[model samples]
Target: MKEIDKIALIEIKNRQILHVRSKGKLKFYLPGGKREASETDEQTLTRELHEELSININTNTIKYLGTFKAPADGKADGVLVKITCYTAEYTGNLKPANEIEELRWLNNSNLDIISEASKKIFEFLKQKGEID
Candidate 1:
């Protein structure tokens, strides 16, 4: 089985999650990306957030959320994506940047529009009563 590893930011407020759409993509995803060689998880996530949303994440304030895995979106069958999530304080205006074309604060009703890995994140958050 093929596995795609990624790191993600889990920023939730008012029972909603921050989701982003990459340019030309059909699905919304949590703000993050795969780690580059030699990058720690925190470094990877922090760099991804800044590149995608122009937000500087406070490395010292980062908290490890849990890791979740699901079928990799847009990949061949039997491929899975493992996403390690973290919540952290950030500084900057949350605007679409780099490959990101749009951003939304999504609730459970919009789950179908997100990637499979993101669906699992929402499920975990919903079970914790983080979103309706």
Candidate 2:
């Protein structure tokens, strides 16, 4: 089995979470991407933020939010994705960049439109009373 390691930023505001739609996908995902070779978690997150949302993450403000795993979406059955998530402060206006198609804020009711991995995060947040 192949495992994909990724990082996700769980930016929450007013009980809503930020999500981005990929250019050729139906599901929305947390604004993040895979880690680069020799990059630290913070470095990977900073680069992904700049590339995907045109923002800069304040590394000092990053809070680890645990990790999650799920079968890799749209991939073979034995493939899995391991996601390390963090909540952080950021600078710069967010805009759809690179391969991003749209950016949206999602609450509990928007679960069906997001990817399976994100749904797990949504459930976790809801259980923690972070979102209603």
Candidate 3:
């Protein structure tokens, strides 16, 4: 089985989680990306948020949420995406940058529009009463 490791940020506001769609992607995903060579999770999160959302993640406030894995969306069967999630404070307004085409705050009702790994995260946050 192939696993794609990623680091993601869980930014919630008023019970809605931030989701982003890449320029050519259909499913909205949590803000983050794959780690660069030898980069730590915090480093990846900080860099990706800045690159994708035009915001800086406050590394000091970073907290581990959970890790989720599911069949990679739009990839072949048996290819899984392993997302390591974190919640952190950020600076600056969120705007789509780099490869991001759009940003949206999503709730449980929008499940069908997100990736499978994101679905796992939404379910986790919902169970914890973090998102509606």
TM-score of each: 0.97, 0.96, 0.98
Better of 1 and 3 by TM-score: 3
Predictions in order: lDDT: 0.93, 0.92, 0.95
Q: Per-residue CA lDDT of candidate 1, range 82-110, in tens?
A: 99999999999999999999999998899
**Residue-pair clashes per candidate, as listed?**
0, 0, 0
What TM-score does candidate 3 get on C-alpha atoms?
0.98
lDDT of 3 by residue, 1-132 (tens): 999999999989999999999998999999999999999999999999999999988889999999999999999999999999999998999999999999999999998899999999999999999988
| Cα lDDT tens digits for candidate 2, 1-132 | 899999999988899999999999998989999998999989999999999999999999998997998888889898988989998999999999999999999998997898888888999999999988
Q: Which rank order by lDDT, best down to worst?
A: 3, 1, 2
Off by over 4 Å in 1: none
